[model samples]
Target: SNLVYDWVKAAILFGVVNTVACLDHLDPPQPPKCITALYVFAETHFDRGINDWLCKYVYDHVGGEHSAVIPELAATVATFAITTLWLGPCDIVYLWSFLNCFGLNFELWVQKLAEWGPLARIEASLSVQMSRRVRALFGALNFWAIIMYNLVSLNSLEFTELVARRLLLTGFPQTTLAVLFVTYCGVQLVKERERTLALEEEQRQDKEKLE
Candidate 1:
């Protein structure tokens, strides 16, 4: 995957750096702490590298931000496709690159949408619960989209079989939603715990300064 998706290398680099930082005092890997290591190494692939650089510097200006959504999506996807072709062609490298671009750009598109002045007034038309529910559902959908992106890059399965698997998985939307809801709850709990820990640490530092 590091060879196929440049982002993987960035994540492994991130993990190794953190591992080394904690090497001095952390407990030894018992039961291998395999799950923790996997969590650290698996998720750090948000890096964009040169592919998205071209998107920002080259294609994004072709129509400016004011362009129609479809054309804009095409131009952005094409930027990565062409970049992959420029690098080299093996088997549907451009296709994965297009998928990769789509995955990356979805976040950007949402950010742009949020920044749109009219979106505030439009969001006002919806109830808070409705908006939150819709956003949470979209989060689950996006998670599946990302699963497809990762599966494509893994390049282990035939394209047709991968499509079949995705079709099979879609039948379990409820399962995905349940998993996402549980994950969200855990994340919120962890975030709150971290916030409290950080506040306590800051207070300790202040007390030390006063002493």
Candidate 2:
């Protein structure tokens, strides 16, 4: 079960990063219009429909007997992360605000952390560890995606202009902010792991004393 959960998380992260890279390389002449269309499609159809469906599926199927909150939350995060990668200037602002309001709120983190029990703690620790790796990988991929897009844009004026506009307006800022967010989350995850380890050690010591 844990292995399946881990693979699903990794798959989602990898798929989102690669999809963003592909979207970034769309036809130079049509980037502005194409990206606008994509943003509209994602917001109107994907966000309202497919995103919810995906989250529900993950919650019902993957989460099973466990609390569905974490998987659903992860799915929502992945959805926004993909949209943020593909959207334009104005939409990017709205998406970023939406994410800040719903996604990055530290209250959610506290709630997740407060859930307790030996099994729950172990599951939470493993989830945090996996998330740390995924976020780190995503951050690195985002940086390289920017670099690759820039390099490809250099060969054509139209493409260069499109890339420059998006970079100035949304791409650079969003990716940079994402990197910082991921790094912060990673640090928090490390602390979570340390806390879990300490608790486990204390329990073991107590058991020995009782024996």
Off by over 4 Å in 2: 1-47, 54-76, 89-91, 94-98, 101-107, 113-211
TM-score of each: 0.50, 0.21
Candidate 2's C-alpha lDDT? 0.45
Segments in model 1 whose C-alpha atoms lie over 4 Å from true places: 1-9, 14-46, 100-123, 158-177, 183-211
Consecutive 10-residue window with the lowest summed lDDT within model 1: 33-42
Clashing pairs in 2: none
What is the C-alpha local distance difference test score of candidate 1? Answer: 0.55
Listing every candidate in turn, what is its Cα RMSD in Å to the true structure after a full C-alpha superposition? 8.5, 19.9
lDDT of 2 by residue, 1-211 (tens): 2223433554565566557867998322111211111211122221223345544564335434434466545545555554555464354344343533253233345345555577466656677667556444544433333333323322443554565466456667886567546645554554456679999999999999999
